[model samples]
Target: MMTFKFARPLAWLLLAFIIFVTVSPIGERPNTVTMVDVDRAVAYLLLGFAFALAYPKQWKMVAMLLIVGAFAIEYLQYFSPTRHPRLHDAGIKAMGAALGLLAGWVINRWRETKAPNGLPFAER
Candidate 1:
């Protein structure tokens, strides 16, 4: 991730943003043209992608965190007076994360095939 050195930190920032948007007052949420489900899917997709790219060796842990965190974070919405939470939404988010994880894994494998030593400059 030399070309994207900030992936790890950025993943954390995205998680923070997700938490804020999930539990904050409805009025504090930003408006978007896409459907609400689509928004959640995309947000978690990127979150999973970032985490996968950042910790390529920890796919199992990352998968657990992103998938479980989806439901865990959604549960937080139950406590918000202005926000409504649904299992459907959590499922969408989890699926999106799973797709993202799959994509990242594909990319990681491709990179490994192209660079056997895990370095662009290393002799094949």
Candidate 2:
């Protein structure tokens, strides 16, 4: 059975992280590598992984949340005078979420396979 005792707190933390990323302006003038877009994407990916790990049985819901959240954030950027929403950014976010989901599934499968008498892992 999945544990809920710690999931609530973790969820809140993840939500905070998402909000921070969504609200904060990234990539300064000229869009130099120092701005670190890759790092930001990885951060979002980790956030997705956290959600997936906390709710493995609800993978569809997790995926939906990630996708919707990414879209919402990008939409919100449209309102910011300092930032403009870009389809490319949304695409990158989606890619990150997908990778995170894949990582989460791999981890879960590994755990399941390690369990006594559990079914062997099979690529799907």
Candidate with best lDDT: 1
Misplaced by over 4 Å in model 2 are 3-8, 25-35, 117-124
The 10 consecutive residues of candidate 2 with the worst lDDT sum are: 27-36
lDDT by residue for model 1 over 1-124, one digit each (tens)? Answer: 4324787898899999999999999999989659988998999989988888778878789999899999999999989999899999999999989988888777776776777465642122
- Residues 29-111 of candidate 2: C-alpha lDDT, one tens digit per residue: 23335545675577568767777777767778888888788878778876666777787777777778778877877786676
lDDT for 31 (candidate 1): 91
Computed on alpha carbons, the lDDT of every model, listed in order, comes to: 0.85, 0.68
User: Once superposed on the true structure, which residue ranges of model 1 sit more than 4 Å away at CA?
Assistant: 1-3, 116-124
- For model 1 the TM-score comes to 0.89
Q: Which ten residues in a row have the lowest lDDT in candidate 1?
A: 115-124
The TM-score that candidate 2 achieves is: 0.73
